[model samples]
Target: MTTSAATTTETPSVSQTKTGIRFWRRLCRNRLVTVGLVIIALQLFTAVFAPWLTTYDPTAQDLAVKELPPGSEGHWLGTDEYGRDMWSRLVYGSRISLLVGISSVVLGLVGGVVLGLLAGYYRWLDGPIMRLVDLMFAFPGILLAMLVIAMLGTRLINVVIAISIWSVPTCARIVRGSVLSLKDREYVQALRSMGAGDGRILFKHLLPNCAAPIIVFATMRMATAILSTSALSFLGLGAQPPTPEWGAMIAAGRDYMWTAPHLTIIPGVAIMLVVFAFNVVGDGLRDALDPHMDVTYES
Candidate 1:
């Protein structure tokens, strides 16, 4: 009897898992989402295997072969103004861009969720926290990031911090809205009435319920983070010279734009492609996760 009862209880969960798998398979059929996933996967793979993919060091320079156009002397994408292989730098640069984007989003997500939960759950904290969020929103994002970068100094970690700080307000607002809706739900009230602690109620009940929006927002925020990091690097506030960061490479190549356009164009395209991929993926997530959307998967 015990074994039979356990089997009966597990069946619904197994069925739900199969249903989720089918839904995901249907979601992946969207052409734009598939392309975005492919592009992102390729970038991550290239970043991870950069050393094996290219023989030349990303930072190595040869003045003798500087500014060679694409397809010259076996350099596939050509050499930059510094004669460093553009293709190698690009491959390596993906690591930095992805790292910064992902790390900053994580930092923002953690801080934002905490603040958002506090504000949404407690009437006393809401006004002050929202006012702070408004203050953060008042400044243009890039400008606020630049200010923080200026204060913190320009290192890779500092760049992540600056971008994360900029991201916090937006994340907080999104999470707060979600939490406000969830905190009053029946399950949350039941948990509270059952003598569950605030921590449990927030983490177990509220946070999980709000996860879809949080995930969707984080996906979209990653694209912005990448673009912002690139912009900061271009302005000399991000990765230092010879760091193989895409934005820093663009900055180095800007002076040579007229003489060697490939230097600028290659890295620029890399940034565009990565950002575009993230945006498309975010859009797809929004559509897939939206409760109001009517999604039907054909059998």
Candidate 2:
């Protein structure tokens, strides 16, 4: 007990730095993680350098070249019904998808962490917060998002807000569970006994301990958030037409599916690849971060 408190109170940075190094080393050792990282890196690179990667403006139109097949003239992935360059829109669309995914996760994380900390630390707050979370959980994730969007009205930012609100329940529950398990630990008790304030104890000590699950949740949530954003856009509750968002593009192309399959196929493939990349990466992180997740073979 003394040793743990001493370690927790003293040299936290040094210990954390060493632990992070070990964690990263273990993470990089997985081949699946390597592949996930490569895919994520490529998507990030494409998102960042979208303009340079594709010459045509994503929104520009030319009726003469509309609905062309892949490899038609300068349009490598072909043009949509509006003659908008599919490749350009796709590259640009990465920015929107990644942006929305990251933003909503961050917002949800903030709200969840606050609610979780309060609920776990304060006996009086637990019931109310948990009940609120339960209320949120009563609705399916997509349906909850839809409800929020219904009230907020459709737009890119609205999509992020709706998704973040939908995300709060799961994130809060995960964090609350972690806090419940951790709040009674020797280190936490020691901190409390040492006259540490709640803020310091919760944020400085408890938060760090809860990081692994939160990180795993956030990573997995990224895929869901991105998918949700696309789903909303597909359903016309997200980025409107002429915006070139992947989901909007998919929605637009559904009408031309019989005549111009590439319009739908290309963007759909992008969503699939991005979502798969995040899922694999999230899984890898979960395995690496979870100390009790060892697999054993019985004789």
Candidate 3:
């Protein structure tokens, strides 16, 4: 009996190790995903080590040296109209963008998952919740966010709240679909027959099954959140001046575009790269996780 139990435990351990190895092999097979991972890693590194990477304060202004071109003394990417170091601002700005993106998505995910669980699992709640989701979906995301910001007044945290609220419908829809499909599966039916409580069945079984799609959607939505944050900042409704946000920096540099294109171009490139990286990574994750995809392994 002892030997049999030990063998059973060892078999599961070996199976789990093979599963993990297969996942990594599939992930590495996608070239675009590899590139995206590298870019994302670099952005994270920049956000975490901004202080050590740059000598100039992002908010510090030297009016006398305004609009210094790229490759100018000390300032590699050059100075904006405010004469603040572009490189430093870009480095620090990554922190704000990533923070807002991640936090807002998490907030949305929590709320969305709860609502979706109710909508999917309970027949009585489905119609009402779906109608509410439809109402939210009627408005464009950014427009809804702007309206919320207008009503709530502009602040960093307010921006996050607005974005989170705007994101709820999308997340809810995704999760509800996943839950609807999962709730009727044999495993869920078996659990129901086994007298599993609603909470236990939903939380332990349904939610865990919905994780892959939710993760992919969240990754993609993060890019959208970053873009929305930048747009709001550009419109003067997000981060205030001297905060070293990329969008605000671009807005500040727009007037001097003819004379110092680097100011606008550099930050624009940074935003583009980050968004693109997230999108590619999301695609990669979807492909890797998709059971329908015929993923090949190298022998």
Q: After superposition, how far is residue 21 of candidate 1 from its true place, in Å?
A: 1.8
lDDT of 2 by residue, 1-299 (tens): 99999888879889889778867777777887888889899999999999789999889998989999999788889999988888999999999999999999999999999999899888899999999999989999899889888998998898999999988988888888888998999998998888999999899988998898899999989999999999999999999978879998999999998999999999999999889889988988987787753332111
Q: Score candidate 2 by lDDT.
A: 0.89
Which residues of candidate 2, in runs, are more than 4 Å off? 1-21, 293-299
Q: Compared with the true structure, what per-residue lDDT tens digits does model 1 show for residues 1-299?
A: 99999999999999999767765765586898999999999999998898899989989989999999999976989998878898999999999999999999999999999999999999899999999999999999999999998898999899999999888888888878988888888888888888999999889878898898888889889999999989999999999988998888888888988898989899999999889999998888887776544445442
Residue pairs of candidate 1 with colliding backbone atoms: none
Which scores greater on TM-score, model 1 or model 2?
1
| TM-score of candidate 3 relative to the true fold | 0.96
Best by lDDT: 3
- Where model 3 places Cα greater than 4 Å from the true spot, the runs are 1-4, 294-299
Q: Which lDDT values do the candidates have, in the order given? A: 0.89, 0.89, 0.90
Where does candidate 2 have its weakest 10-residue lDDT segment? 290-299
Q: Which of the numbered candidates is closest to the native, going by highest TM-score?
A: 3
